[model samples]
Target chain A: MDKLLVSKRMKGRLVQNAILQAIFFFATVLGLIALMLLLSHVVMQAIGWLDGDFLNNFPSRRPEEAGMKSGLIGSLWLMMIVAPVSFILGVGTAIYLEEYALKNRFTAFIQTNISNLTGVPSIVFGLLGLTIFVRELGLGRSVLAAGLTMSLLVFPVIVVAAQEAIRAVPQQLREASYAMGATKWQTICRVVLPAALPGMLTGAILALSRAVGETAPLVVLGIPTFIAYLPSGVLDTFTVMPLQIYNWTGRPQEEFQHVAAAGIVVLLGFLIMMNSVAVLIRNKFQKRF
Target chain B: MGIPTNQEQPFSVREMIVENQRRQHWPKRMEKIAPKLLFTLAALSVLVTLGILFTLLFETIEFFRRVSIVEFVTSKEWLPWNEEHGSFGVAPLVTGTLLTTGIAMLFAVPIGLASAIYLSEYASERTRRIIKPALEVLAGIPTIVYGFFALTIVTPLLQNVIPDLEIFNALSPGLVMGIMIIPMIASLSEDAMSAVPNSIREGALALGATKLEVALKVVLPAAASGVIASVILGISRAVGETMIVAVAGGSSPEFTFDVTKSIQTLTAYIVQVTTGDAGYGTTIYYSIYAVGMTLFLFTLVMNVLAQYISRRFREEY
Candidate 1:
């Protein structure tokens, strides 16, 4: 009886272990499968729309000739504006909080609020942008307005990241700099800022990548569904890649679906390239440290 | 002897003089300026939050004046473009938002929590590192891509299986949104699980518990608060998700609970009104603010709850 009981327990344990292993294996494989499905679906549908004219021409009703040139240019313009503004404001706030502020209730309150802001729905930021930037400020529905909206949407994220990067810099480094008789400003600008630059850059890259892929804020900011011309200025009305894809996908025409897939391929490709560069920079910084 | 002593104290005199001068000027200056700078920055962050609240409130109030609050809240129909017969019932949008978010949480929490358990307890260090970055990649995929995936791929697959699925239904979008948020829950829960002391695991194992038992009975219960917080945050993400719902959840504003039919979320409603030809200053245009205010308030509550739960249950060793 004792021998039978021991063997049964061992068998049950083996079965349980096997089940646990199977669950983990299944999860990992599911993740990979989702990724593969994303890539393959886009590629298979995009190939039919790939041609020379598809790269240079403006968006048209025809699938064989419609290109994302204007949408691409609009995205570039939006990034150019959003990146600098968000970076400066976000990094500045982080430096103040992490380096200068005393640990007090007020500062703690701000910190908590900032974190909450990070959790606030992206759509809320869009609504805020629509009310404040678009209507109250009279920026109108333009690239500048969209960029500003996106900047607000990502501001909290950048600040949070910047704070983390700044916090990760060892206190010993600051002490050593102070011991060298450096002024607070000098220490921050010359020693601390440089040391934290790589992390800050990575954060900025991540935030920008997020902004580039964002569709909700732009959609709420009144991004045009179709724009045949490239934005000539910051205030020029424009369409983004996601909005264009959205427009194409919603059409009943099969041809538009192909174009939408092609747009997805382009958007994903851009995201991958941006992420790769970020990874490269991060690795280089890691090696240096 | 006095002359020799005075000469030997040269270094001390120089250091004392330098320190006295620096302390007199630098410390006073830093003490005066640093607090002010810090206060100003902190104030700015507060101002941003206040600004968002005020902006949403003012516009939302203006919107309510045009459309009665009772009508906006109780009506089941949301047709802003048709001014001749406009009904601004926000219930359907609210229901749709909640249903989709519920579906997303259902998909995200279990998978994410399980993945977190596997990573923290079962996986080797090498596997942990690999999986961590892979999960981050999954998190970093743009919601827009997820939206496209839902519309083009998941929708077609569902149609094949269900045979009656609409071109735009809630299931595919909710599923995709769930997938997008899974990484968030996993990463946060993993952080919580990893923070559990190894001693706890060892104790459970010593009691003849299997690895799975050790994980489920010890680590999960210990990390429950953080896991719950992560789930709340994920739901917040799903509720705010716009593109997927806008694309895959269809454009019809309906209050039905059926996942196979077209629906519209609060965020998607905002997107719809904004994209269409709603003229500036029109009641329809102002209705976006009303919808946005709802979304903002809902998310704000979730966020506050998350912060409260995280702090209240925060464990320290």
Candidate 2:
């Protein structure tokens, strides 16, 4: 009788285990379903609208005549400024905190401040851009202003990633350099930077890709949606791909929504390319040591 | 000591040391300069924080000069358009933000925690690898796309079932934002759960506990602080999110708790005001800064609280 009771209790526990496991499994399934729906829905709408004309022409009142040329060029110009500036600033900050800064209140404050900045809403950064870069500096919704804003927005991401990469460098490498009587800069330049390069590059590329998708900040900068001319310089007024997509999506017509989806496909294509390059750098160049 | 003997003069160490130091003088100068330069770069981040603070503060103060602080805080309406009869109370926008965030959390916490539990305790390494990056892809998709998805697809689908839903209601954006943040919460909580020692699970199993029981009672408790921290961070993200709400959360500023009705979040309001030609120095223009300051404070408090919980309640091995 005791054995039968034990068997019954064990069976009950097994049943409970299966139920909980299924529940957990389905939770992941739900998220996957949402992802799949979003992709398929966008792609299905973008089927016929994504063509050469869509990429070549400027946006017009008519859907078929509309293209993302100015938006694409504007985004390109913005990245021209964002890529170099953010990389230099981000990697520099990472190197300082990891290799140079003494452990003290000031360094600690900078670290905490960076963490807090990452949590600041992108729109707040937009407000910052509007006030300082746009109004105070008189850049006036130019690509330079937008690019600098995006750089600050993505700065924390690159810094944190680069810091992780720098921290992951083995201490033995630095010790060997010190043993050879190498100065701090020599040790860093020779032993540490090379080891950390792949990770740093990956982080910078991913951050750039993120900047591509950012729309709210650009919108808040008051970059008008219908720019007929391409931006030739940093100071030229510009609109980005996401902002174009945003404007299109907000329109009352059905064709504009489809056009927005096509724009999204192109934007996603760029993002996928960037992300794959990041993965390739991580896999192909990362040193095992 | 001053003069070397004839035998030692051929290899004088002092002369050689001086020659090498002089040869590397440029590098030595650069070494001194590099730290200061990098420090300046690092300090720029602090300047950014100060810029954001002062810009918002300066304008918000200007906004308060026009409208009393008490009326701004206590009033229910937000009508910056009607400057003469405008009610500058921030309550409607705050309520709208809270409503969307509440709905987002309601959906995200359960699914995200469940997915974290599955990934940490149930899935094999292969399944985890494949699923993890896929979820990250979900996270990587832009918020603007999510906004489009909510407006174009989700709303139409929801309208079929929930007939009372407005064309641009809070429910669609709230639900879509919930989907957007799921990956964030899942990945963070998974990292926390994975940090729990395997020995704890072993001990539970040795005591005749089932796998579910072990995960529920042992690992979950051990990783409680981390999971909570992740959820808090997710809440902050939801609170600060702009485009999704701006796109689908509607533009009307109303003081309603109903998710089916049109409402405007603080972020959506900022977008609305900024996108319009709110001429510089106008009440509407300054109001964006005031609204932005409120959003900034909300996110800052949540972020600090998350950091405190994670650091304070960490379970060290």
Candidate 3:
């Protein structure tokens, strides 16, 4: 009787384990399914809408004539400002914290501040851009203002990535540089920077991709969705791919939804290209240590 | 070892002196200025925080100057576009934000935790590589796409089932927002679960515990703080989300718990006001900052709480 009872309890436990595992498995499957559905749905909507004219023509009331030309160029202009500004500031900040700053209350505050900034919603950053850049600075919803806003938005991400990369450079390498009578700057420039460059590049690219997809902060900056002409300079008014897609998606016409899907395909194409570049950089320069 | 010859010298005396002066001058100036430059860059982050604070604070003060604080908080209406008889009570918007955030948490937590558990505890190496990237891709997809999906696909699908769902209801956006945040929870929780030391798992298994028992009872408890932090962060993300709600959540500011009806969130309100002509210094204009302040505070509290919980309860190996 005791043996029979013990075996029965064991069977029950086994059944419970199997059931729970299946539940977990299905949960993961659900996420993948959602991804597939989103992709397929967008692709289906984009079937005939994604073409050369779609990329070349200006946005219009007519769906067939609407193109992302101004948006595509405007995005490039935004990147021109965002890329250098964010990279220099973000990497410089990381180098200061990791290589220079002593561990104390001040550094601690900076660290906490950065993490908190990361948590601040992108929309709040939009408010900041609206007040400081667009209104106070008189940037007037221009590409430069939008770019600066995006720079601040992605600043923490790039800093965190650079810090991790700097931290990963072996201490022994630094010591070797010092033993050769190198100064702090010399050691950092010669030894640490080289080793950390690839990681920093990867991080910066991923962060920039995020900038490319960002629409909220730009919307808050009052970036117009109906710019027919491409921005000729940084100070010119601009729209981006995501914002264009948003404008399309919100239209009452059903055909505009397909245009939005096409815009999504293009925007996603850019993001995937950027992400794969990051991945390529990581794989090419990944050190075993 | 032989005496150095003039022909073997790589530089003339003038050249050597010039190079030495150049090096000394450049490095000395850079060594002095580089730290300060970098420090200035680092300080920009603090300036950003201060900028956000003062911008929100000043505009919010301007808003409160026109509207009574009591009415702003206690009243249930949120119509600010009507210049004459517009109501500014934020309660309806708060309720809308809460309802949507609640729904999002409900949908995300279980699926996210389960995926984390499956990835960390059950999946093999190959399966994990495939599954993990797939989830990352989900995370990487822009929120605008999700907003479009919510508006175009999810709402229609739900309307078919519920038959009473509005074209722009809270349910679709909330669920889609939940999907947008699942990766955050799954990735962070998986990191926490994976950090659980191997010895605990081994000990549990040696006691004849089932795999699920070991994962749930042993690893889950050990990483509880981190798991909680991820959830709080997810909540924060949902609260701050603007595009999904702005796109799919209807613009009606109503005080109702019914998920089938249209409601306006604080973020959606800000988008509406910004996109329209609120004009500078109008009550409608300043009200955006007031609403933003509310949104900012909600996210700030959640983030601080998450940070506190994670740091306070962190278990060291």
Candidate 4:
């Protein structure tokens, strides 16, 4: 009887453990289901709106006829401005902090503040953009203001990522360069940066992905909800994918909702593509290393 | 050794002096200058922080002057664009943000913590590898997609379950936000839990503790600091989340605690007000900065608290 009781208890414990593991497995599966459902719903709702003219023309008051040409162009323009500027500023700061600066109180303070700034809400940056870029600087409600605001939003993330990438470069490589009589600047430019480039690029892509989807900062920077014409210059008033989708989503018309769904599909597609590329780069770098 | 002839001599005093000066002076000068330049570059990070604070503060102060601090803080109404009268009560927006974040935490903490426990203690190596990357994929999904999911799918499902739910209420958005933030909490907490030494679990098992008991009593205690920090960071994410709230949460800025009602958050309000209504220098416009300042302070405090807790109480073993 004692032996039977022990065996039964052991079986019970096994069943319980199996159940617990199954629950966790299900939860993870549920996350995937959520993502899949979102993608499918977008595709289903947006199918009718995916025509040639839809991509070619600017937005119109008529939902059936409106396209995303201007918004797409505006987003491209914003990217052109934000991407390089953020990459340079963020990567430069990271290199200085990680490779050059002494580990002291001042550097520690700056590091802590950078992390804190990363936690600052994007809308707050929008407010900063409104006051400094839009009003004080007289950039007006233009693409330049939006791009500047977004650059601030992505800057901290890029800096953090770049710092990690730079730190990952082997210390021995730096010493080798120095022993070979390379100056500090030459060592960084030639040895450290090339080794860290892939990681830095991964961060840049991630940051840019975030910037592209950002709606709040752009909204606060006063991006127009309705722009019939393509933005012509940096100072030209603009609308981005998020703002355009937002405008359509808020409309009462059913057709407009369809258009909004289509816009979301396009936006999500772009984001997914960017992320996949980052992953590819990361994997390639890992293999090379 | 014999001395070289004058024609074959290495250098005269004048040439030697010039060569020595060129080699010694400029490099020493550059070494002195390089660090200063690099320090300035690092200092730019601090400058960025200061710039943001000063800009937000000045604009917010101007905003508060137009709308009294009392009205802004205490009043429940937030009608800034009305012609006859405009109210600047920020209470509802604050409440909405808190309520949604609270709901998000409720959903995220349990599932996320459990997942952490499972990954750290229960899962096989292959399962762990697969699940970890899958969770990261969840994190990689943009917030905009989450917004759409909340708006289209979650809202409809919630409406079916809870009668009287508005088209854009707090429940769906908060729930979706929780899902979006789960990877953050789970990943951090998993690292903390995994950091607990294997000896603790072995000792607990030797004492005849069940797997669950070992996980809960032995491992979790060791990882508490990390778990708490993860939760705080999750809260910060929920608070700062913009696209999800702005898209799904309604624009009705009311100071009510009802989760079923349409409410606006500080982020959603900033989006709404800034979209087209307010001119550049208008008081209505400066209110965006005021709202943003409040948000900035809230997240800043949370981040500082999380950092302090993690740094102060982090366990090495």
TM-score of chain A of each: 0.95, 0.97, 0.98, 0.95
| Model 3 CA deviation exceeding 4 Å by range | B1-22
Worst 10 residues of 2 chain B by lDDT: B1-10
Q: Report lDDT per candidate.
A: 0.82, 0.93, 0.92, 0.84
Number of clashes found in candidate 3: 0
Model 2: runs farther than 4 Å from truth? B1-22
Determine which window of 10 residues in candidate 2 chain A has minimal summed lDDT: A70-79
lDDT of 4 by residue, B1-317 (tens): 25656775557788867766876777667766766776776677787788889988988899888889999988878888786789988888999999899999998898888888888888889988988988887887667667877887789889999989999899889999999888889899999999899988898899777787788888988899989999999999899888888888989888788999898998998888776566668987788888888888889999999988888998786
Worst 10 residues of 3 chain B by lDDT: B1-10
Ranking the candidates on lDDT from highest down gives 2, 3, 4, 1
Which scores higher on TM-score, 2 or 3? 3
Q: After superposition, how far is residue B182 of candidate 2 from its true place, in Å?
A: 0.6
Candidate 1 accuracy as TM-score = 0.92
Superposed on all Cα atoms, the candidates' RMSDs to the truth, in angstroms, are: 5.0, 3.5, 2.2, 3.9
Residue-level lDDT of model 3, residues A16-94, one tens digit each, is 9999999999998797798789789999999999999999999999998999998888888988988999999899999
Best first by TM-score, ranked: 3, 2, 1, 4
What are the per-residue Cα lDDT tens digits for candidate 3 across B1-317? Answer: 34547674446789767766875897878888888999999998899999999999999999999999899999888878766788899998988888889899999999999999999999999999998988988888888989999999899999989999999889999999988888899999999999999998999999989999999999999999999999999999999998999999989999999999999999989899888887998998999999999999989999999999988998888
TM-score of chain B of 1: 0.88
Query: Model 4: how far is A128 from its true place, Å?
Result: 0.8
